[model samples]
Every structure is written in structure tokens, then in C-alpha cells.
Target chain A: MAVNDAGAKQVATYWEGMVNSGLADTKAYGTTDFYNGLGSGKYVTYLAAGWGPGYLASVAKTTSGKWRAAPLPQWTAGGNVQGDWGGSSFAVTDQAKNPEVATKVAMDIYGAKNTDAWKIGIDEAYLFPTATPVLESDAFLKKKYDFFGGQTVNDIFVPAYKTISPFSWSPFNSYNFNQLTTGINGAIEKKTSWTAALDTAQANISQYATQQGFKVQ
Target chain B: MTQVETRSATAPAVAGPAPRFKRGREAATGWLFVLPFVILLVAFLLLPMAYAFKLSLYRSTLIEGEHFALFENYTQAFKDPLVRQGVVRVVLFGLVQTPVMIGIALLAALLIDHATSRFSRFFRLAAFVPYAVPVVIGTLMWGFLYSQDTGPLSSILHVDFLSSNVVLASLGNVVTWQWAGYNMIVLYAALQGLPREVYESARIDGAGPSQIAWRIKTPMISSAIILATLFTILGTLQFFTEPLILQPLNPGSITQHYTPNVYAFNQAFSFQQYNYSAAISFLLGAVVFVGSYIFLFATRKRSAL
Candidate 1:
């Protein structure tokens, strides 16, 4: 929770209210467990990755047509909100016998020229190619699923990805996650205030990053 | 000439010495017999340890290729808060879990050792079966049993067994159940090795079964108990599998840095910080070595008695 920034501070206040209202510790649930919980109506909303809906559908078959993808809520009215989760990038390593050929092959997989076809080849369940042309094409944008009541899911996500706040990862992201969760656990257990937890996490992460020879801010 | 001939006749005859070439060939054959094990150990264990140590001395990253940082990674590992906390948490876990586990094991070993019935063998096998189960499988089974939804524990106790507050105890229970039998087998073997005459003498001296167990058998087998304790301590400090498998079921309680080894593992694989991970691992190894030494030293006099 942010203490200095007014925008973040406001969101933090709202988050505190949610916690006070008995926001169950979501970390206790694994992917499958959470999916089961969702299907059982144990949770109202779940903030998830771009691929979350398709995954939910496969796991929670009985919950078809019940759930919908919506843009995340904003701290202030008319403000935009978006976040990114896990993803991998393709690269041609130095060990490649022909780097140019490797680069070309990598490019073709997600390139604008052939990405749409590749998505089709993968049966479209493996969704969300990051190629601009593929994303804007009718095939991708107009795709609908029975899971979300036949809504075009990308219509909600595409615009959301555009206004997402720019974020960078530190080399110590794993260590950062570990400390962050520990602080979160403390807050969830009611052993400490969320603000204190965040402060501690920030101090610990900065120290950790510095020790790892990173240019910590 | 007569005296010399008599001395030569009196001297014992000796067989010719083994051929030098044959001895050399025999030595080579012996080495050949052990060659497979030696190669495997060096390839798997020794080589990896050497490489890990070398990696620990360098800092590798996407931006800077790889550069030797000397002891920089080790220093960073020493300073890392997560490493410190994880080590401390495991030490606490070891302190509590090791004693209880060993106590249960000693009791079981004593009971089985003294039993005259045919069921003793069955009971011994039953006690040891949990240890035979793979750690991941055992932990997962325990995870299911601890589940609030499907497990009977929550309904019976009206409390969440896998919740943040009680998850550690739940994990401890799993470890104790799995390993107490293992330590019991070791202690039980030692009990079997004890001379029967001591117990017979104790019986003649009006010593009851319980008395003989505590005053005679227990003290004689103190060394085996210490060995069990040492292993338990090391195992506890290096605790990873149970928590890791259970993490998915209860992440809030068991974070990535739940134990030192887990922290090191996450760092190396998840974060791709192999150098730092190696450093953390060596630090943990150092702790384990020193801890074991101190324990053995502390118990030296008692075991001597």
C-alpha cells in the first residue's frame, strides 16, 4: 500500500476496506483449488492473467455462461486500470548455429505476417498473440466463446492493455515476490498494518536488490 | 661345513613371492570393480559441487554476461533478509520437531525391542511404511487430509488445518509421522544389538521392564539416539519437499522462502539468479555443518558416560 502518492494511497484505502470486510487470503488456494472455488460460487471476483478466462472455462465447466470478463475497477472515475502477469519472450541465443535463421524463425512465430495463422493452428484456445496486426484483425477481435456468454473477450482486454501503467522488473523479482508475500501474510494474519507490511517489504527488497549489485531505487 | 648344512636343513621353507606383474594386475582389477561408482560419484556429486562453488563466486545476469565477483555473492547471501529469516525459521522448526520425533522413535523402538509376540514384525513394518513412501506423494496425501473442504479434520475440529495460523503445525505433524518411523527403525536396530545379559542382570536385580528400558537400555543406546538426533536436525534444517508440495495448497503460510533450501531453489530456477542461489546453498551447508558439530560436541560427555 502506498503512503506518499495520493492516487495509490486512495486505492490502498479501498483495499484496506476490502480486507476488513473479510477478503479471504487467496494465496491459500492453488490454481485448481481456486478454479473449484470459483465454480462453487465461493468467490465473487478474481483478478487474473490474460489467459484466465479460457483456463477457468476448462476447469469450471459447469460455470459456463455465468462469468464475464470486465475491465478492472479504477481508483477514480474515468481512470484506466490494467496489469500484466506471466509471459515468455522468444530470443535467438548466441549458441544458435545460424543466429539470423533462428531470429527469423522466432520472428515468424509471433510476427504480424503469420501470427493469426499460427493462432488458428493452435486451435485459438492459446489466445492473445501480441502482434499488432493479429490483435487488430477481425479473426482475433471478433472471436467469441460460450464460457463468457459469447462475448468477445479481447474487446475488453485490448483497450485495457493499452493504458496499462508501464512497469519494469528488477533482477531480484523472485526475492521481491518472496518478501512481498511474507508481508502480505503478516497483514492477512492481522499481525501488522498493511502500510507497515508494505514499508517493510520495500525496505527489505531494496536492501536485497542492492546486495545483488542492482541499481536499487 | 657340517654346521652350515645343519642350519640350512633346520630353516623353514618359504614359497616364492607373488609375481610383481600379477599384483599390479590384481590391483587394477580391484579398481575396475569400483570404477563405475567412482565415476558416477565424481560426475554427479563432486563435479556439481565444484561447479556450484565456482558459480557462487561469479555474478551472472542478462546485462553483464558473466563476470567474476569474488565473494560478492556470498556477502550478498549473508546480508539477504530472506535467507536470514528462512534459516531462523527452520532452526526453530528443527528444535521443536527433532525432539518430539526422536522421542516417539525411541519409544517405538523400545516397545518393539521388548515385545515377544509375533505381531512385533508386522508392527515394525507398519511403522516403517510411511518412510518408504516418496516425500512428494506423502506430502500431497497429507495436504488432501488437511484440506478444509474434503478432509475430515476441519469438520471434526471446527478449525482450518491448512490455514495460515495452523499450517506449520500441520506440516510438522506430517514430517513427524513420516520420519518418526524411520528413526525408530535405526534406534530399534541399535536396541537389537544390545547384549541380553545386561537386561538379564537388571531383571535379577528386581528391575522392572520400564526401569530396564529407561535406566539400562536407554543410556546404552544414547549414541544411536544422538545419531538419530543429528540426522533429524540436518533434515529439519534442510526441509523443503513437504513445504514445497504443500505450498500450492497453502501459499499464504508457506511462501517461496519457507526454508533456506527452498529459498535457494526459487532463486536459482525461478529468478535465474544461479550465483546467488549457489551462495545461499553453501551458506546453508555451512550452517548445517556447524550446527551438527556443535550438537555432537554438546552430547559428547553424556554419550561418553
Candidate 2:
């Protein structure tokens, strides 16, 4: 991480605003409280990836038709550079007993030519259209989701997806995540200044990377 | 089981005479009865521990190929601030929580033991009910109660229980709530088994109810209290579940390495450092062992003071 203290603080302030505003509750996750809170209108917004709305529809029963798809709120004015939190992938491993059949099934599941497969994958399973055919399909582009009050969410999402910038990943992704969380958490708790927390995280991650024999720039 | 019993019965009949052979036959039957348990003990406990010890002796690194690095991981763990800080924090937590829990348990047990009303039965059951609830579930419940907004306790008390300043104590509360009931049941059972005549004699000696409880009853159950203390100490040293469960709510307070067991878990699963994780786990085991040993040694005389 570059350890941009001001940027980190801005991010912290944004989250703190929600928590302070009583819109977001930092309640423990994986509990009934977590699930029921959002459904009960305790949480106004759920931030997640392209596949997130599908999951929201399953969990959000009362607010089904009240929802609308919108672009993520920008951290900075016109800040279109984006990141994602979730995606799905498929593979036919060498361990498969019938590798040829497995490959065919896996490829056909979202293959460009398989309209029926795309229908099930896109309309029913709520998968993001990855194939070009599915992306250009009239049904996909114009379809109105009842959950979002019959809005064509593809109008918002298809363009939003293209806004994502190239993100370089670290081999030590988990370490980076832990350290970043610690820094942000410390900033949120007001235990340390954002700069100090970020500096400490930067130092720690650098030292760890060095220990793992990565050249620290 | 019947086949083994039949075999044992037939053994003495075929081979040996009555007197000295009785001992051998009885020993064989005892071994037969314990064979399954011994096998499980070796397979689950001893073997896994042995493998972990082996793992602790080696570090597999990206640059350096896997090789014997005897005590290197141990040395690193000893100096690791996270490990030291976590140990000190937990030890302090145990110092506070263990006694508070045991004191509460003993008080509850004594009150129930000598209660005059029918409500005492209900109180005893109520106290024991938390023990029936799983620790994770109990922690989750407390997490809700501790939430700053939704929880009535927080709104009423005007405190954020999961705040960094107080989260450690908050975790202690969860563990105490979960285990106090179990300790209460143990102490209560011990209290029930005490001879009634001792209390009668104490009363005749002009001892007040409080005096009788503190002087006579407490001393009588010292062994069970010590046993419970040992268990609580061990549990406290390896504290993980509550902190782990509540981490997401207060991420900074309950950092990945907030406790030794949680640290080991993060190191092994998150960082993929199995060797270092194993080393830390064993070091924590040593700490727990030494902690209990010191307690037992200090109190071994059991009133010689």
C-alpha cells in the first residue's frame, strides 16, 4: 500500500459518517442480527460486487420492490476508478474422471453459443453476463428486474463495470488485508491518527515482505 | 465387548489357578475395557501433538527450501511483540475474570445450597442454563447486547462495550458468562455432597451463616475449587472464540493476533505459516502448563498457611 494518510482518513471519515448517522451499525457479522438488520430497514445500503444484488434479493424480503440499482458513491468527485469484492469462476480440473465431458459441461454453462445456458445463468442464477453474446443479448440488456422495481439495472451496471481500473495484486494479499484493516480500524476507533496507523501498517507490511524475500522498493 | 468379556472369562479357566491368576485376569479385563479409549487418545491427542511439535521445528519459506530450523521459530515467537502482548493481556484477563467467575459461582452455589425458598431451584437452573448455550452463541448474544445502537444495555448504560478501551474486559465478560454456570454446577454438586452434620455443628458453635460458608463450607470444597481454577486457567490462556467472534464488530480492538490461539489460527490459515503457528500454539501450551503448575504448587499445602 502507498499509505496515503489523507486518503485513508477520508475513507475512514466516510464510514464513520454512516456509523455516526445511525444508518450503519457495526454489529457483529454472521449472526441473525446481521441478516435481520438490513432486511428490517436498519441498513439503507449494502455495498458489494456485481454479483451482490442477486444475494441481496435473496436476503432482503420486505424491501424487495423498493430497491434500485445505482452506481457506487464516489470517494472523490468523478472518481470512476473502481474495485470489486466478489466474482465467480469455474474450472474443470485434471482430477476429473471424465475430463472431456467435464470440460464441455463447464464451458457450455456460460458459453457464447448456449442461449438456454445463458438464460439460466443470467436470468435465473443472476450471474453477471461475462460472455459477449449474453452481454449483447436483447433480453439481458432490456430485462426489468422486479426486485429493483422493474428497472433495467443493466443500464447502470454495464457501464459501471467498464469503469474498473487495473488493480495490481500482492502475493501476500491476506497480510495486506489484515494490516489495512488494523490501520482503518484504529483510525475508526480514534485510538491513533490515520497517518500513524497507516505508517505502522506500511512499515509492518514492508518488513514482512522483506522477510518473505520480496524486494522492498 | 461381550466377546472380550467371554475371552477374559475363559482365559483364567483354561490357563491359571485361582489365587495369583485372579490378579492377571482382572488386569487383562481392565486393559480390555480401556483399549478403545487408549487407542483414541493416542490417535487424536498424542499423534497430532507430536506432528505439531515436528512442524514447529521446521520453517518452510518461499526463498529458503524447507529444512530443519530447530528452535528458530520458538526464538522468533519469544521475541514477537504480538505474542508477548497477547500473552500478557490474556494473563491479566485471567487474573480478573477467573476469580470473578469462581467467586460468583461459589456465591451462587452457596446461596442455592442453603436457600429456604423454592425459587432457589429456579435460580440454580437459570445459572446453569448459560452453560448449555454454546460459547459462540453466547458470545454472539453478548455482542448484540454490547452494540452501541441496537442494544438496550448500551443505550441505557451510555457505553460502547466493544470500544478499544474496554473490548478486552468485554471479551472476559462473555467467557465468564459462558463458563461461570459450569463452575457453579460443579461447586453446587460438591456443596450438596457435604455432610449436613458439619453445618449443624457449625450453627451450634454460634457461627453465623456467612461465617459458616466462608470458614467451613469453602474449606471443604477447596479441592473442587482448585480443580475448577485449573480448568478456568487453561481455558483463559487459550481464549479465542469470543474475541474471534466479536472481531468484525471492533476490528482494531480484536486484531488478528488478539489472543494466542487466534494468532495461531491466523498465522496458519490466513498467512499460511503453519510452522510458526505450531510454534506459537506449543508456546501457549507451555504457558498454560506452567501457569497451572504454579497455582497448584502455591496452593498444594491447602491451608498450611
Fnat for every candidate: 0.27, 0.46
Candidate 2, what DockQ?
0.45
Tens-digit lDDT track of model 2 for A1-217: 4655677767766666766777666655545557778688787777767787787788887788988888888867987756667576777789999999998987777578888988888778888777866777788878898988999887777777777777777888888887877776766677445556777888988888777777888
- Candidate 2 chain B, poorest ten consecutive residues by summed lDDT: B12-21
Which parts of model 1 have CA positions greater than 4 angstroms off? Answer: A1-5, A23-25, A29-33, A86-95, A99-126, A162-182, A208-217, B1-30, B58-82, B116-119, B162-165, B194-205, B270-273, B298-305
Model 2 residue A57 CA deviation (Å) reads 3.7
The docking quality of candidate 1, as DockQ, is 0.26
- Location of the lowest summed lDDT over 10 successive residues in candidate 1 chain B: B7-16
**Model 1, span B6-64: residue lDDT tens:** 54354333212546654565566567679999999999999999999999999876545
In the range B1-305, model 2's lDDT, one tens digit per residue, is 78876876787667665666777777878988899999999999999999999999998866665889999999999999999989998899899988999999999999998885889988988988988998888888898898776777887989888887889888888888888889999999999899999999999999999999999999999888988988898899999899998888777678888989999999999888899999999999999889988988998877222
Q: Which candidate comes out best when scored by TM-score?
A: 2
Q: Every model's DockQ, to 2 decimals?
A: 0.26, 0.45
